[model samples]
Target: MSSNVAGRVVCYSVLSPPRRSRREQIISQLLTSVGSLREHNRTVRVVVFWLGSRHQETEDRLRSLEAQVVHLGSYEDLLHPFPGGDVLVRYPVLHKYFVLDAVLEDLGTSQLLLIDCDTVFLDDVDKLFERHADVDLAACAEVGTVRRERGYDPAYLDEEHLARLAQSLGGRFVEPINSGILLLSRKGIEELAKLRPALLEITLRLMVGLAKSAEESDFAPLVQLRERLASGAPEVKGVAPLGFPSSNHWIVEEVALWLALGLTESLTMRDLPPSDAALGGEVYRRPRSASSWIIGHYFSVDTAPAMSWCRTGQPPHASPKGRSRAADELPIDPALAASPLLVEHEGFALYEDLFGLDVLSEMTREAREAYWGGQEQSLTARFGGVGRDSHPPRRLVSAGGGDVQDAAYCSPSLKAFLESLCGLEVEPTGRRGSVNYYTRSGDFMGLHLDVVQCELVVLTVLQDLSPADDPSGSWELFPGQVGRPLPSVSTGRRDRRSIKAMPGQSLVMFGGLVPHRVRPVAAGQRRIVSALCFRAGQTALEPPTVPQD
Candidate 1:
């Protein structure tokens, strides 16, 4: 197919199934992404490439819009070169590139947004182009999603990957890039197309590296992939393997794309605003704000992962209720200056009077009212790390909602103060704010990483009747122990430090990386605190990463 008119085109590469749910998903992406783009930019054309089994109704629906639907032959046809195409057919990521390559050939020098079918454009495509007009390509950095170290099983090493990539990339060690939402200029597209052969070599090398590093019995997928490469076969079995772990396959495509991008020296490139382009598995972690979410990429179409992913966030009826927030600039310069930084540890920070304390009055009053008003639940469970070994009993009073919840969800003052101290801009997360009460004698949470949750968490002591200095009923840290450990607070290790964020004070830390817990409450003591979550701010210059959900 040839484009009659195009300055830039928003392209989607899809592999749909016959299932009703999947059809609904495709329609959702179409309705949201195409709808949003059409509402904002008419100059940009929308192109849909169907790379799997075709359904006539969906094809007709695609035709109804300005979208030019391009039907690529079935996945089996794509695997023609692979002798036993059945094995790798399910994940057509590598083959998807062929469709994209065809697009470049037909469209010639038109700029493009090459994205996955599960992705939705939350904002204008034209505005995105104008904002990054200087760059030939832009994509989110995916270093956080893929691990660079070898675990018990063989894995790719970042150091070696970068060394090899840098050699081809003019001595630049570019971090891995996610191909989910790519913004590419004409030069970028041509350069990407040029990398076809080399990228294949890199991908095969990756398969070899993983195969070489492990025993054949350790990784079945690596063994099969290695065997196919050795025999120069296109497919493993006669057909695509059923119920394959598609996640790992997608990672290969992401790494291949990263290496391919690195090989391009003629084109200028940068990272897309991370918060704006919420990549696969990250869609849920992003805060529910329109300006904050300009794009979303779902990881899977399978019922299991997709269902869980869908539950992460609700479909917003509109952009948001108000105007976009101002960028958080540091050194808040509050006249009080009461919130002094006490000490900064590895991932934890100690502050005496954090700016979030200003809301303690209302927050505490609300918590008290809610607790007395019987809008609270007494939770009793042994909460610890991922391990379920020896967890101590934990009891706490939990309640949601108050006058301060909404304001806390996106607080500029606290964000400013945190940015000043941490030296990194942050955005308020936590879609709903809630209060945790440690009024019971055994109210304590064991050490655990927040994991796949907020990067930074702020805990403000709204009202603590316990002895401020007592370690029995306050927050405590295992001090730099990121390793997943079911550590007991009763061990009395000297490294264990109980934080004294007394009434009106707060403690902030990388909750996702650091291992922390709260001590049990004393018999007569009462403690109430509210937590505010945040993530490192995303900008075109920097990458935003939320741990994979």
Candidate 2:
């Protein structure tokens, strides 16, 4: 299939069985993004690659859309068959490879642009073709999603794995780009295919044994890098990855606009208008444009350990509404502020004046209850409620756990809060950050600070009104000069701090020098607050107060 029209290019990708609610949201985003192309009549073709026994409902929906739909038969025919889980993890990479192979070989189209399903096309991306034709491949430069020791540490992977990734990337980290979005020329797609065999070998090997999470996909680029290193090639000599100077780093769609800003990094608040009403608080009409609003790390939040690869917090839907503190009512006594304010090591300043304090309070209260309430006492009982030694309540906290930990998962309020803070509704990095819970008896998490990978934490305490013994329940740190606990919060402890967080009161700790521990609960009944930790840089703004007439 040859492109008779000069402007024709294939735009393709895939989506498999997703949670019902998520499926709707992603579908809406996909249609919204692609709808932009319709104005140009640019003949945009979308290919959705799905695996497993086909779901006619899903296929029908895709077919209903004007775009093309390709069901790649069974997952087995696609590659060394991995479980549905493994398949889902590598689905994007595989889908791109399949689409490029099909589009180029079957349609004979050389030019292609691959956009992830989640993207929303605010403007014509056709310019991507115009700009990138000069380079063999063009992609948004690698935004450091997860912090890596302030420099190119590259410590996550060993030599063998790194070498494999560099090799698979075809001695070029340029093409196959972010896979979230990219523009690939015919040669680029062909080169991607050429590297498929080695890439698949590594993918299968990792999926079966080595890979722990989606990080396996990095192997493609690592293999390519290894090849270059083995040949003693200079880093700059290989294919180049395009850098968009003006862009905010996180996963959200705003990165596209940042790239649109181009050369001018120094953006005043006024330069970049609020992306939406939700962002108005954190961003404003600055007189000048500095480099502030553009960069990946600035907007990142902590998530699960495996997700440490990117800073975006857990998937947008997973975050809970963490507590909010009002700047007007200083948590620390202003009289005590004779010198620079002292907070925990990771602590950072939070403003409640610009963003409203009430909205956050209401939302946090509701979220605290909804999350904990949704889980059956039976389930909480499964972990041993207060002091049942028979079950021996494990301190296990994970994405699936529904305690305050659910805050790691964003709720609508949480998303609005973050959008206000970051000035955009950034995408959530698919990482699950840590959440800690302490129960009576066998249910205690010993004193500990989060790992480097853990960015920020919001601690919210929810306990029964009735209390007993140990007078424990207070957040503790190494005893100060008086040998009593001192609690100044920071990241991993950010958010407002509140003692006696009975039914509604909660605390949030941002970055700082604070180390904290929960006091023990009485034997009769135990108290618990769902403690949630997020990837760093992914912070939120309180909602503005609505003035009454």
Candidate 3:
């Protein structure tokens, strides 16, 4: 069957019925998730369903993006006082349970990528199918330690009850998992329709039980309760809290899925990597480190300034980097504007058009032609050559032949430009430059600093075209982490930036001082990069000194 016959879908819910405020706020978030769709090879239909009266602007925006808007009546008409309906209106998060079954029915045999509204996708959502097609249920496991003692955790899921529910269903125990980002096949979804009555009962009972046992507190039902549970820390001490997993019931729908799974004899499940579908505070706090994460469940986060590309029938612009910003133009310094377009900061500047498109296009063509496709370099943990302090294997095919370097690396004008950026004269180091190929699927580079010889690191993504559905091989730069441990780059690196440099762009970083690595290359992706190193001295005459790695 052709893709035109039927396509897959990604689903999200937003600002519930009668709440017409925060229009642009939701639009930005919608763009964040919608913008991420460009990374996917197969076109995914965006379906926004809600128990609501539609906001005209949001509908118009969705129409402009060619998204299909599915409005399932109003809260007063569809789900008045039905079982679990009380919590559904009170907690907007639980609304998915009401809409997903219908979505699955329409999808028939195809699957659905059910995600939160505030999520930002990093790679393709189709990866869930590639990795977890065999499983009936797959979800991103809650990051960090699982506080079993708390019984009900961050997702407001009653893990203890869920464990017993799973045990009662099929003697299989499920951990505390976030259902905000979930994958569902029609096979399992079919069972959900048949079990809808029982599922609602289970949801009602769970909500009542958690609420009865919940401690007394004063948090405005939706906003205050959700914000605090998501960002704040209060004591649970084993007993249930007031709003968490109880009255608010953000995770009740996830719990309903667990209940429904028990009735089905063909239940199978897997946990997706947190690096791929991160949730909560991690989405906004450390986007650079979590940049490779394709889907971010940004529940209540509004400070996601570094918005990804939002290409829905429109050009990839919208952020400072992505085509459009607030005014569509940044405050340009007259002198800086006259030079090459760049996003400059203290020690970092992302040159949007370092080498003009035509020149770099030719350079990229030359580098690809010059590649000898040498032996596959094993940079994996098993392919150990560097000392004990070496990074996770830099597994990939590399050709460091001088021809390839000379073909693209040694540009006289480029070096002169670099001299200005570095504030000193520069010369190619012994490792002048090398073409690294992320040949096979799953190939990656662990976090590590460049060798001592690398003083000025210049890297350009010659060709990042990948046939893989989940192609997320981007350059993650850790400018803020110089002296820190190699693996420490993923967490809390304030200045870390995950960059997927286009063919025309180039980056100049003090590689020896900044720790960095490449995210794993997905299947059908051939990631080729041209990395060149240079040396700089205190004065133009003295031998250049290397920064300690």
Candidate 4:
């Protein structure tokens, strides 16, 4: 009954065996999760429920891990109320709820923590128990859904059926919760037991209705359900008036739990702040500085490589062999080391006048003139040999194939300087440099990581014609941070750190690892920049051609 008991009890379920590779993946995840949990909480007790036929290797592994394994028997009697044939056999997720029910029936513990096997503890979770001590159930809100939007749509729900279900619960449905990481007390379990029958009935009805409706409509049942949920329905019975469609095969348990909590008068549900617990891909991409993150669910197959590397401290290769380039080997220049622009932890540097002012000025002038002349000639030819009255400038051009600016950027002295500063031997890629000429307002580059061949990128500002007070051109960098995913063009701009680069200044970054972008240019502004790409350990006179821009 004490909070200590709750902190000690950690429960998880593995229902069926997947493919050989997936099985191995699950085993690895369990080992890492249990190992990490034991390291941080010596008194932690792990309980795993096996729902189907016995997997000897898995059972032995769990035993070796000092985990108590419970094999669940036939749930025919409990699932009989649901019209579906062998619901337990058909859907493995149902096993999680049944496992909890079995545990409550047998164990004397008043509180328990339910975690998915795909998750690992990052920090001590004692605070989580204390934080939700007063609540009957607590879980993280599901991302990419209306759960956090505080409103629900009705198109996905069988409105009349949902209205009937709400009448039975004496309340309405609320925002759905993710059950990946959950905390449940004795009272909460009891509430779920009372509501389980109605939950099953409603889910069965919804599933049948959607299946029947799908035969007549073009949309899938799940899609129709989601569409209906997105409709902003009025709140009813002190809960958000939302309904769960059973067509959502994977999230039935979560839907049932949400309904139980909202329908039960004595039960309470609390949203676990995202900062405290992250699920799926969000876990791998959580910021390293997020010390408050207690549980992380690396559930997605996309995160398998990262999870393997994080757990084993090695590359996820069959041969298990690889080389690493240590950052310490790169010595920093004492004079430039203390500059704020040099982010030592992120392997980047920003320098003013990296290229001499005179060189930059001459290159900028010539490039601008060449571009303008080319435009004028094109215009004159287009107008039947008559010189055009005025000519607009081209916004962008590839400054490659032996351009003067390209030659300046690839100078021997500059290459040597960069090599010394970063302690890495490098050579320029054969790809032509990009001459971005932003002449119009709102011209912007989205955040993105450079191609793999571009180990390093040297971006030099050739010209900025914006007003001195309203300089619109700036470099935004998403530095390489631990426990964070590589930022992408789709990510919000707020996550980036912007730096204004004056003409002649250069920004050096690990192009393939760090995500960087250029801010929009304002009206009446003319900004010109050059991007030079480099590869590691290649000194050949000619390099393979690759797109750099």
Query: Local distance difference test, per candidate?
Result: 0.56, 0.35, 0.53, 0.55
- Worst-scoring 10-residue span by lDDT in model 1: 329-338
TM-score of 3: 0.46
Better structure of 1 and 3 per TM-score: 1
lDDT of 2 by residue, 1-549 (tens): 334355346464544433332343344444544553554444555556555445566556555655566666654466545323233343324545555666666455656766655343323445445545654455443322221112222221122333344444344221111344555666666666665544444343333322222121112233343344457555223323322211111111222222222222222211111121101111111211321321111110111111221123222112124523222221322212221223222232233232234533543444333322121111111211111011221232221223233334455565455434433322222222222333333233333333321223444444443443244455544312111112222324333242444434444433222344455444433444544443333221222111100
TM-scores for all candidates: the values are 0.48, 0.42, 0.46, 0.49
Q: Which one wins on TM-score?
A: 4
Prediction 2 TM-score vs. true: 0.42
Give the per-residue Cα lDDT of candidate 3 at 227: 44
Winning candidate number (lDDT): 1
RMSD of each: 17.8, 17.4, 19.8, 19.0
Residue clash pairs of candidate 1: 82-234, 84-235, 86-239, 86-240, 87-239, 87-240, 339-353
Tens digit of lDDT per residue, candidate 1, span 146-256? 431211111223445455555654545556666777888877777777776666555555545554442212123454666765686644323222111112333655665
Model 1 stretches with alpha carbons more than 4 Å out:
2-6, 17-32, 79-91, 105-109, 143-160, 165-172, 215-223, 226-249, 280-287, 301-549
Error of 1 at 533 (Å): 27
Off by over 4 Å in 2: 1-4, 36-42, 50-65, 80-93, 145-177, 207-549
**Which wins on TM-score, candidate 3 or candidate 4?**
4
Ranking by TM-score: 4, 1, 3, 2
Ranking by lDDT: 1, 4, 3, 2
lDDT of 3: 0.53
